[model samples]
Target: MATFIPPGSSNDGADIDLLGKELGLSSGQLREQLNALYARLRLLLTTDELGAWRNESLALFRFSASSSAKATEEYFRVAPRVLDILPPHLFLKWVKRGKALCHDSPGIAAAYFRASPQALATLPERQFNVWLAMGPGLYKRNSESMELAAHFLDAAPALLQVLNLAQLERLLLFLNRLTETDCSLAIRCLDSAYRVFHALEDDERSLFLSIALALVRLKPMASVTFFKQGIDSLAGVTSTQRLRFLTLLAKIAAYNSRHALSFLTDCSHALSGMDRNLHPRLINQCETVLAISAIAGIEFLNNSPAVLASIGPAGLERWYREGLRILRKDEKDGLAYFRLEFPEDGTLERLLVRVELDHVRGVLLMYGEALGGSEIEIRSSDSLADWSLGTIDPGTPATDGTTIFLPSSIDRFDSAEENFTWYKVAVTHQSGHIEFGTFNFCFESKAALFSDSRQLLSADGHGLSDMDRFLGLFDDRRLAADIFSLVEDVRIDYLVQHRYAGIRSGYRFIVQESVWKRPSPVYLPLREAFLEIVIRFSLNGELPFVPEALRGPTDTALRLLQQLRSPEARVEDSAEVAIRLYDLASIIPNTRLPQRDWNAGGSEQARSNRVDTSYRTSDGGDVTIEPGAEVPYQAPTDVDFRGNSNPDMLNIQPTPKDGSDRGTLSPLSSDIGEVQLNSMMQGENLQSGQYTADL
Candidate 1:
């Protein structure tokens, strides 16, 4: 008669018969073991899936022990996800490696296969095996209950999004490798790892985890910190900026692991307000601290954030790098100075450079408000990122019509007053766009100063907006846009010059500076060089030399723009000027000028940067562009000012959450009353009982 086969597996009786011979088992015993394996899986898998299961369960062949089948059988019932953990393809290999594991602890391999998948989703077969072996040992000495331990295992896949399969394995290995193997760090990893990943790019995640794991081993006792505040602080800092925190962690780990988290938390708090660009400097500062000694490093890191914000990055670097002097004189003295415990005999104050955002905010705001003809909110240029307005360009000021955005600080200038003047120029230019309506031009719109004789290349009556119609004419949208900008800015600068007397000095200074730094006319491509000359001519700017080929259009454009100096010139007139300029630019090709010996004229461009603009003196004096004492500063080229300016804006205020009316001031109070004081005695009660008044 044929041997009776099991209900689930299609493996013939021959396979079981061969397995019995290898393990030195009788037919009856082997059949019993196979029957037990069949029973556990039959409860969970379909008949089709059971075929795959039978192939994997053959790992039982590697084990001759009587209890191997039984341990797996019991564990399989609780672990419905075991198949997910050990895919049928990898089961045979995993089982072979399980020999030593099964020998030391009879049921551990099955217990892991069952318990591990319940917390986290099925990992790649290889990653599963690492966790399979390590899972049982993680909480071996910890107070974590089985369910709580499983809770941490469940978080693996979410973190896996930020970490690769290999990185995930390394993280687990670090915990398992720790002599005490703090399970709480694993729990913290589950809690904040997602957030830490949020702040890091995928490539950066590996390095961050590497440093974290290194900290665990270097100061194994630091798990208290790893569990409490460390991971949360890690989330607040970016991956690139983590070097500072890492070095600071190392110092604290060396000094006393107890202080690491506090120092890390303090540093994160300080970093929260800073720009990410400054992080590299912070790292360099931390290294300098470490170079001094453990105490000195920790102290410097602890106070670094505030010092950085106070002194600025350059100043802070100078301060930290200078600490080597005190450290050389007396390391203890330097440590106290960095910690701010001692002021270092005025050395700390000397190193400090107090620069506040509010320093020039009010002045720039008022300057913009006066020119913008509205109460404009002055914000940092970084705020421009929030606007959906087209390309954002640095160095050019932008306005949303309601707010003028400038660079966050003006360290580019020496004094606060000088910085305010610089900021004033940025605000005034952006505000001028709003006041003069540089963005108001429409296509096919008639210009008041010059007739629009350019033929419409497209259907004139199509439903295109003026902007669309105007922009459609040019093959190069960027070039057309820039030429229009140069013309409009010249008109706006003209208006601001005549209207706001207070800002003319800065306005003239910036315009002059731009002309001074303008790229040599000969170096620019032919058409671009012509556009450059026309722009300089519009600015009343002096150029080193104008190409002979461009002289005709340049002369005509200059003559037409001079009409704008008339009191009758309006925003409409400027639009006409833009149209004329655009016409001149249309004929020019976009290519470099072919010339011999280009370098010989470099010094000439430098000498002729400022052209004699017929400037109208502040007190109704004769216009003159006569040379004055040289104040050297560079401004972006005219192409930069035009081509690189941010898009014309739209109102970008966020939708009000409650949609409350913005028509009126919020009510301050509905009731108004004053309480009369009882001056009879020091301890007199006013209302609890009757009190006598002084007669």
Candidate 2:
């Protein structure tokens, strides 16, 4: 059970007064009497001899019931003194310990308050107000005590009402200091103050705004939210009164990029109407905004030309120059920025020129001027300007002509072996004249000088023979014919031979071929015959007699031969094949047969001359006969076989005269009248025999 004491009793007090009074007594005088008493109290408090001696006087109140009231009254009187003696930090600890131990004894608490109201009132107000103004220290000795003090401020209406503008300013300064010391505590303090300021009337709102601005200047991050709240709290303040708030916000904006954009966007109208008198400050703010935008790649100033212009020419130029510098410095993003800014067709060209790539071949091809006319003359070796031109009139012969002239330093002559030549020829028609605007010819080669045309052709002719040998066989008839035709039609004008040596030999021929027509068959069977002979020769190792030497060796010939000789070769015993051969022979009008009697007794001769002479003697059996045959017969008057009679056959017929009687004529002759028979068959037996063996 806990003992209860009146407000001014010793039993419920912390015994702080007893300890203070004992400090005035001599240690030798208290020692003998306090030893056993200190031991017992030490045993109860779980302390040793040192602490027991120090707390010896408080142990006296445990035995005397009247001492509780005295102890509580003394506690109130000494608490303020202890606060005054101790540092602001330790004073909070005393308050908490006193409250915990004496909480059950309300009489003791009332006695402490009634005995020293002035000290009680003054001490809490002094400590808490200082804490509120100066911010929380590094160590919070009694957080609960601090909280209790904060609550006390709410009940102290007189003190709050009496806090003048100067005191509030000091408090604001203290809070700023706290923000620098402890940011979290500064946030809490500002939060509490914000609530208090909002509860104030219009005049108090203005005062609070000033205080908030001061704190914002000192601790922008901590005070930013509170400052905004203060600005909102000013429901009746004019725009002019809000100038300082805007200024503080602008400072906050200047420090943080995100905050700057937000401030600019949220307070755009307010910012625009900002005092012209604060031009320097405003300009500083703009500089910060531009800087952030440049770094963050935020297009804050893009759509607002008015805002950009408001920054003035000098500021914008500085910004632009800095941005360009950044672009030039960063390798990857720099090029990207340049591309975005100056996206023109020839921008790359201009950039290359700046990098001194005017003489670079690739650059020249991409961006340089072209050569034109009969001769493109480069005057000097260094620059493009040192140049001249020569005429290239059409329809005129190009003999000994200067086709192109380049700088002597450029090595105008190039071998045709190492690399190919690329020429770009552009032509345009103006008025009645056809003008070749510009023609660029680029030759990549090894030779360094131009030779005479005749010599060049002679060298080239030898080179061609070498090529023909290397190619193994020049079987391209069309190519050969084309060369022959060219030689026949065009006159030799000029030539240049270029040579190079590497893995293999290389050469080229430049010939001027006059355009002409020749007698060429629209369709030629010679090509088919040539191809057939080529295929046969390739397959069989020998050509047909008709075109043995005409068709030469070629890949097509070889391939055709291989296919024919392969296992999968197609074999045909077709009647169509035979018929085709026969048709071919028939179409050949000059075809002749060998010297032999086809009608002789050879198998073919027998087949041709053997006639199917059938005698159907009213029986089904048929008999065939040869061409020459003889049989016994009588002749009629109309059948005159007298002069051409066969010796073996006898014709018995009397010629009848016009007056003679028809009865006198023989019946045999009349019966066989005008009978026409084969005489060669009559000489031989009527059966079967050969008649014309020699014929």
Candidate 3:
């Protein structure tokens, strides 16, 4: 049961006493009127909430209304719910403002009083009044719908969850700030704000508001042109990347409050015309450059999407991260380079080396189509941003059983061929999941290849998916899922390389790249070192550089993993390997290199030489390891071909009986068709003031 303690009142008797003193009512008459209010209010509030309502209720009596008692009895009915919703101070402040607003338009004063509590609850007190106070001022100037001006408050309730109280205040303040001189423009923004806020993520909402705030302070709009069209401009951005992209734009406004509003608006105008879903690493790396200067951030914003459309997320990320390093060293030089303000920045020449999305999109489409033997569109998993509002690794990919969603950029490797091969590995591994029936596990049936696995679940089980029963065998499911992924992916890679002789070079290159690029094993502790070896072996490396102390455990893990590569191996075989690896990893201490008496070597530098130089990052960039520092073994998020890596194990459903819906069908292409003409057209439209209209 939830405790419904409302703010500020001790009991019902204290309320009667306070109201009697304030209203000059005799004790008996006060009791009668207060009782009338209570009867109507009990449906909305608990006894405790009514207690908190006392002080704010008493404060509303401070307003000099003619029929104070009757109006309080009627309007205060809804106001009780406000007590349940707001702090006592905020509620009192809101009522006082609404009383002040009433004096402006007496004709609709009663309706304003009736609606004020809910409105104030939607936005913080100050902003709700800021927008509300404008209506009557407009009415005096003969503005239409002045009486309906407060309808903007109706949008408040829906927005409270999306934008917290502080953002709501800033949002309204920005509206008032922009429309202050013109009542007509102010009314348009007030009406459109709800729809705009509804369509945007909270971070995107703040960027629009912050830019508006900056712009209003700089130059008043000839009209609220940008305000009206800004939200529509963001439809091209991935929800995952929107907040960071928006936040960096906000920093530009913060750096130079006056001109950045126009600057960011101009940049957004350019961003509005791209094919955001393809070629693509859906990365937001260039945002860091914003801290260097607004010009740097804005310049990247203008140029990056098209560059990304051409090279994909990988090449763009490399360009941005490298530019940021320069930006950090000298602000002016970095700024000049990114803006193409100087020739030495090598901006044009570096782009020449970039691997275009067109180069690999076809190769991957063929790799996937060959494996699934169905036309599969290799979709960019950029939509994950919209699905979740929180942080997710961009490297992780998922299949809806039809489209194999892969990261857009393959810039993890330096050479274009190596990057293309990386794409082939990801697409083939995911297609393998659909090619094989990993999702079609049966809970109670005996294993086709391994014995006694069914005993892991209860004898009389409730309805659970086969995926659940299979994973239930392990205590540490995350570790089990990871091991299963490594083993299953290895199995799929073998099959892909075996069947497609054409992609053999690409497939072998990625596997060898995984080993060559991995952190040297000498830097890790005994157990982590062993696990790293396990990963290396799964990539088809033969016990490469295993330390003498861990060679025993590494060999044990190798024996189990090798069995999983057999043609007759089943999901049970992968599960057994996962269990053994879990047991072995459990005993291996999770010791950091700096720990006293480290086992890697007596001296720290010996262990540190093996530090991972090629650190995998979300933006398809790598972190360089400084000398004499040990890099911890961080696992990569591989595509789980078995569909066992998802955390929602209980909800896993059985695969469809009909093969028709087993995997999502895609037509022949996933190409990103972009041309410079599209941006040029939008640019011309923006400069023409085409969005502005007479109010």
Candidate 4:
């Protein structure tokens, strides 16, 4: 070797000598590093029996010689790690790509070479080449984007966990498109892509990437929010529904790409508050509007739940058809209809044969103000049910102290007048609770007429509320609660009937309707039949026929209920009567009544079973049985207009008050403790629970 040059070292020794000078190292030190890299590559080549490519692969190192000293060092430092996974031709291709990048950004070239092992390790050869091609293009799109491109390359391994190669490519293209409008937002999206994409299911990542791409192409400004709020929007949609939701987003993107993300966000929010079964039908409805105008379609989707809630599900088609007619006639008003801001004369508001709270909230608000003589807000009962820790029955009206909550719509009868009457009935009953003080229970106070039994019962000391302590006296807390609710409703209805004469007819009609819906006592168990009779009697004051054996106890229960009609009756009086009713119900056996032949007025078997044979303690005491098997105690069916009562829940405290204008109130101090009675009355946020008005 003329000068003792190593084999094939004529070219290799010169390149190593050149790289050594560029790296500020002597030939020996450079050779030492080269030997280590060569040894690592040698093992890979020998294992695959492709040792001949080692020299060819080493020849590619010269490609980085013209780059910065740091770039060349990074190139050699990661050469073996990259080549260990890439074949010789692919290595040549990667080095050439880095060489191309170095011409524009030497720092990016170093980052690319340093991050190549991870990128190639995570992606297939085809996808790796595609990703490699993005580096120089990204830097060229915006000079400031080179740093984010470097981060994107370095984050490949983690990104691959959530996104496949196709998705990654689409994301890169989206970022590239986004760079033209807002380079900083594009950079932010790339930096956060791994974390954002990681939150989605494997199947959702690709679809979301397509959506991102579509948004960036049409409305580049939304790309940043698509990465932020877009993930949150997906959370509102179920896994099974996300595919259709994203597909609809893409369809909207094609027509009105500017509002595509909004449709996605708003529709997902609407779906969460509504029934899951309605999602498909709702999508079809939005798509129908999407065919006419993209903005109107999105507006339609944004307010769909409110529309469905206002008009009921039965009215969705009519509402949609009305909007479509307007859209076909005039896009501007059609947009207004979908936004629910249509003019007073618009037919869209008249399409449903229901009474929506929105149309009647003001009138009822005035009515509540007049009756309660204070500022009373009117809200949907569903709002309180959503915030309540206890079960707040749906399709009912309730009061949280200050506000009167009613159903979103009342369509129990066909005409709007009947439905509006139903609303008035609800408003009046709930307002009566505030007007007559249903929540003003004082455990230490005496009843207006009935004897107080609460003091005689032992205190459990676990009661955080006066109602809780009062109900805690009985062995069957649920039974005691049911009795108390029944008595309080009676008192409220009695006062409502006398105080508001205009609503008496509607109230009577509702009570009669409830009576018609009541289960026949003839088929009920003896104990449940007694409670059902009391409920019916309280509704319209018309008691059904009772078996002779149960007539005495039933009369006693009704007499205790009648005590609430006194004008001086208080919530404590309702509690007192509940104890008497509870004692009366406890003595009766829970056996099914012997079937009464409706044709005959009486049956001996029914009369025999109804006789008070035994009593069970609330603390799981045993009892004597009738001839029939003892059935579990069942609460009576809910009275529609009475709504629901959770006095025990009212004892919980409100969220700590802040000096803000969110209408937050100071905690209402109770005689025994600092309970948040006023907050509950006002429908503000609670400490033990949370309230979201949007739901």
**Which of the numbered candidates is closest to the native, going by highest lDDT?**
4
The Cα RMSD in angstroms, rounded to one decimal, for candidate 2 relative to the true structure is: 47.6
Task: Output the TM-score of candidate 3.
Answer: 0.44
In each prediction, how many residue pairs overlap at the backbone (N, C-alpha, C within less than 3 A)?
Answer: 3, 20, 9, 7
Q: Write the per-residue lDDT of candidate 1 for residues 521-584, one digit (tens) a residue.
A: 6756656676776667665555446543444455556666777665456555665666666677
Could you tell which candidate, 1 or 2, scores higher by lDDT? 1
Alpha-carbon TM-score of each model against the true structure: 0.45, 0.18, 0.44, 0.45
For candidate 4, the lDDT comes to 0.69
Query: Every model's Cα RMSD, please?
Result: 19.6, 47.6, 18.1, 18.1
Better of 3 and 4 by lDDT: 4
The total number of steric clashes, by the backbone 3 Å criterion, in model 2 comes to 20
Model 1 clash tally, residue pairs: 3
Q: Which of 1 and 3 is the better model by TM-score?
A: 1
| Candidate 1 CA-lDDT value | 0.54
The deviation in Å at residue 163 for candidate 2 is 11
The residue pairs that clash in candidate 3, if any, are 7-52, 240-385, 280-408, 281-313, 281-408, 281-409, 401-663, 401-664, 402-664
Q: Write the per-residue lDDT of candidate 2 for residues 1-695, one digit (tens) a residue.
A: 32322333454234433554554323443432333333333333322332433543343233222324444444434544454444434444444434433343323333333323333344444454443322122223344433333333333333334454454455455454554555455446544654555455545555554545454554555455554444453332234434443453445543553454344344444444443433333334344444434332223222223333444322333344444465546644533442334445543222211111122222112111111112111112222222121232221111111122112211101221111111100000000010111011011111112122222222233434322321222243232222221211111110101001110111111110000111111111333333333323322243233311111222233332333232221111111121222222222222121222111232232222222212221234442222332222211111010011111111112222345442421123222212111221112112122222211
Residues 610-682, model 3: lDDT tens digits: 3221232223444322234333435543422222234332243324334345454543323221222122112
Reference-based lDDT, residue 644, model 3: 23
